[model samples]
Target: MTIAEGCILVACLLPIACAWIAKSKGFGKPRRDGGFDNHSPRQWLASLQGWQARANAAQLNSFETLPIFIAGVLVAEHQQASQPLLDALAMAFVAARAGYIGAYLADWANTRSILWTLGLACCIAMFFIG
Candidate 1:
């Protein structure tokens, strides 16, 4: 597979890392009695505080971003675009996504949004290069 294709696999792993960190926060502990009942895992996660909550949000965001990234890679590949350029853009997407996770967890809303925009731009630019 091309580097762009490989980036999709790396993209898939990003959310798992976020979730692992979030889940670790409450492992083997009862859910704090928040508004939601602990009967469901979703409810339990909703009770996560501070960085854990941000991590969960980042995890969700990663899933939201993946399909667009996958589509971009597919388009670039299908169009027989410059392999080196596509690979560089794909790598940039991965790096931006990693930065997004950090920014989100750190509660840096402006940085997170900027990273999100950057990732989207990278994905969209791949289509144009094709």
Candidate 2:
């Protein structure tokens, strides 16, 4: 796979990382003692608060943004866009997404939004590159 394609894989895994963050504190403990309850995962996740809650929210947003990013990369590749430019944009999108997750986990609302926008712009820019 190309560098851009590798970036797509990285982008796809971001949400999983966020989800892991959301559940990190609850790992390796009993469910009754506030551990990650696999039986009722949604309920357990719903009960999260603070940074964990934000992580969950970030995970959802990551998932929501993934389709567009994937589409942009695929469409750009199909159109024979400049490989280096496409790769750069894809990498930028991944970096922005990582920053967005960090900002979310840190409760930096404005920074998170800015990073989110940057990621989106990267995706949009991909469609125009050739």
Candidate 3:
């Protein structure tokens, strides 16, 4: 597989990492004691606060952005866009996403938004890469 395709896999997994960050504090404890309730995971996540809450929010945003990124890469590949350029954009998208997640966790709202926009731009650019 190409590096761009590999980036798609990494992009897909990022939300899981964010989810882990959101629920980490609740791990290894009983559900009744405010631990992560796998039985009602959504509810548990919804109850998060501060950086954890932001992490969950970022997870949702990551999931939301994934489809476009996937489509962008696939469409670019099918259109015979430059392989190296496609790979570079894909990598940039991932980097921007990582920055977004970090900014979210750190409560840097403006930085997070900027990174999010950069990621989206990368995806949009890929769509016309051919």
Best by the lDDT measure: 3
Select the stronger candidate by lDDT from 1 and 2.
Answer: 2
Q: Which stretches of candidate 2 lie over 4 Å from their true place?
A: none
Predictions: Cα RMSD each? 2.6, 0.7, 0.6
Prediction 2 global C-alpha lDDT: 0.95
lDDT of 1 by residue, 13-121 (tens): 9999998877785666554634333468676677779998999999999999998899998998999999999999999999999999999889999999999999999
By TM-score, how accurate is candidate 3?
0.98
Pairs in steric clash, model 2: none
lDDT of 3 at 50: 96
**Steric clash pairs (candidate 1):** none
Point out where model 1 deviates above 4 Å.
Answer: 30-39
Displacement of residue 87 (Cα, Å) in model 2 is 0.3
Per-model TM-score, in order, reads 0.90, 0.98, 0.98
Q: Which prediction has more favorable TM-score, 1 or 3?
A: 3
The whole-model lDDT of each prediction reads 0.89, 0.95, 0.97
| Candidate 2: worst-modelled 10 consecutive residues by lDDT | 121-130
